[model samples]
Target chain A: MTKERKPKPVFIEGAISAEFIGNSIAKHQSKTTIGAHDIFLGQVRADQIEGKTVKAIEYTAYEDMANSKFHDIREATFKKFNLTCMHIYHSLGTVKAGEICLFVFVSSPRRVDVFNAIEYLVNTIKEQVPIFGKEIFEDQSHQWKVNS
Target chain B: MTLKIKYFGMLAEITQCEEETLSFSKGTAADLLKVLFEKHPILEEKEFQIAQNQTFISNDSIISNAEIVLLPPFAGG
Candidate 1:
């Protein structure tokens, strides 16, 4: 006899909500030896750049590609680090300049790997994900976000 | 064969459209890019990258005759 297992769909949702993220984290937890939890929330900054006031941000993504890349990132993180659970959420569509664009939460049995894993997952997501955000200035001018 | 190519970021600006179909034979993605650059000279120094489906491709890598997608620098946070 043989058994087959289907991979869980990579939890990807593009919405402008924080409650959804909180719920995701709640569901990911189980009765395991989880000792540490670390989270990184990226908020949109209202800043003055070149004499322009920032307005809202428009986010776009290659949906199919982004989903697949996220799956790979999740798998790689699990393989490279010891973690109890992890969740990554990013907003799409329009987000105001003072809104959040991304959130990453990682939990592990110990604290050491959680920190490194969080950093790695976040860095990789920024470097590899096929997502773009346009920073709309108050004057209606626009600029693309560049990862530096 | 015709390769359905998609563009993003500044590359989309240079192409003047989000996507287009190009007639290209089985060759490296760089070749198609070179041809694209020839037609659109503004893409010469745009600082971009490429990906065939889900896999990242180097500048000199060969692209299959099948449909391929081109991507620019990522900005996902």
Candidate 2:
């Protein structure tokens, strides 16, 4: 039996920009009556927790694991729902506060699938991927970020 | 065979190291974790995730005694 190849995680060190993600979304759109597109952009916020001001975010991942998870999620999503195309992009390395960290784009023939697909993609990424983010404070103190 | 195990975030702090390789038989992923957690008791209290050959696996995922990556709860956008 042939072994299946695992998918690769799209890793970008530093920041995620709207233009970069927008271009990726554009490529998936087809001329065939594609009517709806839904997008979710996760931006880092400069927040003071306790006594520290979060200055930036540093993201890292088990690349091999993250990519594999992405592929599985992609396949499962396609099977569970009908969709035209989906794209997921997340930031690696250092991302300053107020910069985007995660961008998810989905397009479909109708509006309904796009909404559901975006939510599913975002949630699955949060719940499944092995990517981690470290919150760097202005004072140089750091903490790991976890989705609540 | 020996496999590398990695720690992240708070788990890394608790473990006091980022990565280490330990010996194991050709066992499933769960078996490796059982031994690791026993040696590092803090892991038992914390919730974490596992990735075998860079792919995320459920706790019950059938993993051979190959290299695996361990991760804690991640916080990313």
Candidate 3:
């Protein structure tokens, strides 16, 4: 029989702090089977658009749908790679430029599994998830950001 | 059928509201979008994708009267 696992909630209120990420690593120390850990942190960039600088990104999502999509990604990663554990965190509100907005953590007993898994997870999340970001400008003007 | 339509990101800016229940008589996803276009002409110039009942659908897909969400290009990283 397959064990049913509840999907881990991934949305953070604002920017993901460095302390929280550190704590996540600390908590994983007890999982001795994990010999390697790979992490991907998405930091917001300050882009100059049409003579205006981007101040921050205000993120929003169809929450129920996003959560389910994340679960689907997790399942696919597990099926495609031999992983001991995985975690994903994404900011739901305003994240200032240079702050972390998305974090993906994966652990495996072998180094190669995590290297490939991280790239796959990040790309899939960007391409498949429904999360949206509004790039807020310094002067309060804003524009929608699309993944390219 | 009254369909619950949700707007996200820049699309919400065009719609001027996050969500609303619109009475849509029988039609495909594209047909319902024609109604939205009449309500908000600006949406006609924007790019986005449609998801019915949380699953992405093509514009020509038949509507099953489920919750429809209009998503602009994804920017999440």
Candidate 4:
């Protein structure tokens, strides 16, 4: 039987810390049924626009819609994959260029499930979610970021 | 009807506010866009999508008394 999972908040205030990521992995140790784990982390890139360099990214979202889309994605993923568990987190406010902004973790009983699930989750989040980012430059000017 | 319109990302920057309530006449989503375009002409040049009550709607969809959102191109990871 498929278990129903409640949707949890996914937005973090700033950068997702390494410590938090480590703790999440540690917490999954008790779930012995999972043998393979796949992790994807998205870091802010300091791209050069003209002569300016990006310093940080400020993120915003249509909260209600984004959350609903995330929930739908989660449901669809569970139906498509034979995975044990999954977690997704994205930054809300400003995150420095070198900091982490998005983290996706998926675990399953076998390696193939995790490998495929991680790709789907990350790609879907980028294409479907209503989150936006402002690429803030060092001189305080900014440009909107669009997924390629 | 008073429609609450919310703007996100670059749309908000162009609109100069996150949200505002406007008194709109009953019409389709395209009609509402005409009114918004007159007020914020720059918006016509930008690319975006429209959502009503958190659901994406096409241009011909009828507008009701509900929350509307203007969303730019998504950049999430």
Candidate 5:
């Protein structure tokens, strides 16, 4: 009998570390059937607004809805792409500028599937996910972030 | 009926609270907005989407669920 897969938790409390990402990759080594892998990392940019420099981003979410939407996106991606596996992670709490906030990993047996799948996944996450970011300036002022 | 409303992102900032319950005797999403605008007049100037039971709706949809969420522009990557 095939094992039923459960949805992985997408939101973590802080920035995604390089060690975590490296370990994720290492775990895939045993799955020798995958020939190509693609990754997308979204970093918090220190954006300057109105002459104020942002020092960190405090992330928040409609957690229930965001997770459901992520599940839908994952299912849709699997239906549309020939991906061997996929993983998505996003930060929920404060992440400083220059730290990683979002990580997506996708694998496929061929390179073309991964090249197109990564772009689709990234764009879909930006458009559909119910996650918010507050840009905190060095002076303690803050502004809400909007996707462009 | 009492409706549970959650405000997120910039909307939360404007509302100054994340969630609250509104005793809405009137029906549907538009009616709720009318009452909300009466309280938070500044919301009329802001752009957002209303989700009923986690599903987004436009104007004049009947509200069948108490769980409503106000979502501002999505900034997630």
Candidate 6:
């Protein structure tokens, strides 16, 4: 039976630690009906631009609007896929290079649904959400990051 | 009527403030842009989309909402 889910807060203050991700996976262990699981992690890359190397990224968002958009995405994903549960988390503040900035987890009775749902959720979040990233360079300079 | 306007991302950098209130009587989104452009000329050169009531609207869309947002290119994952 599909369970009705409410929109939960998705923004984290800083980098999402491995411990948090591990705990989340551990929590799902009790749900034996979930036959497959899929996860996606977005890491902050040290990109080079204009000869300056990025050291970290400072993220910001239109919180109320972002949360509303996230809720819509969650609802749509649930409608499209036969998933048991899903979770999404994104970093709001400075996330250094090599740190995890976004985490998406999905589970279902089978593998195909989890795979498709993960892709849709990540792409929709990237294209539609109002989250902004300011790339901080090693030299202390910065520039706005645009998804390419 | 006073409208609350919000600027996001690079657009906010140009405006120097994340949000503000402006006194505007009646017009389309284009007319509101004219007033904003006059106040912050640099905003005219920046690329952005206008949203009202959390939904994107065309330039000619009538301004009936009390809140508007200027959003630049999104960089999210």
User: Candidate 1, DockQ to 2 decimals?
Assistant: 0.73
**Candidate achieving the largest TM-score:** 4
Local accuracy by lDDT, each model: 0.77, 0.79, 0.92, 0.94, 0.92, 0.94
- Name the runs in model 1 displaced over 4 angstroms: A1-16, A28-32
Residue B59 in model 1: lDDT: 70
lDDT score of residue A32 within candidate 2: 73
Q: TM-score for the second chain in candidate 6?
A: 0.96
**Per-residue C-alpha lDDT of model 4 across residues A86-129, encoded as one tens digit per residue:** 99999999999999999999999999999999999999999999
The candidate scoring highest on DockQ is 4
Candidate 2 stretches greater than 4 Å from native: A1-9, A25-32, B24-45, B50-64
TM-score of each: 0.87, 0.81, 0.96, 0.98, 0.96, 0.97
Worst lDDT run of 10 residues, candidate 2 chain B, spans B61-70
The sequence of per-residue lDDT tens digits that candidate 2 reaches over residues A18-93 is 7887687677655476788889999998989997899998888877667777888887877777777777788889
As a whole number from 0 to 100, the lDDT of residue A30 in candidate 6 is 98
Give the docking tier of candidate 3.
high
The CAPRI classification for model 1 reads as: medium
A13 in model 1: Cα distance from truth in Å?
6.6
lDDT of 3 by residue, A112-146 (tens): 99999999999999998999999999999998899
**Candidate 4 runs further than 4 Å off:** none
**Residue B68 of candidate 2: its Cα lDDT?**
71
1 or 3, which is superior by DockQ?
3
Give lDDT: candidate 3, residue A117: 99
lDDT of 5 by residue, A121-140 (tens): 99999999999999999999
Native contacts retained per candidate? 0.71, 0.71, 0.88, 0.92, 0.87, 0.85
Q: Poorest 10 consecutive residues of model 2 chain A by lDDT? A: A1-10
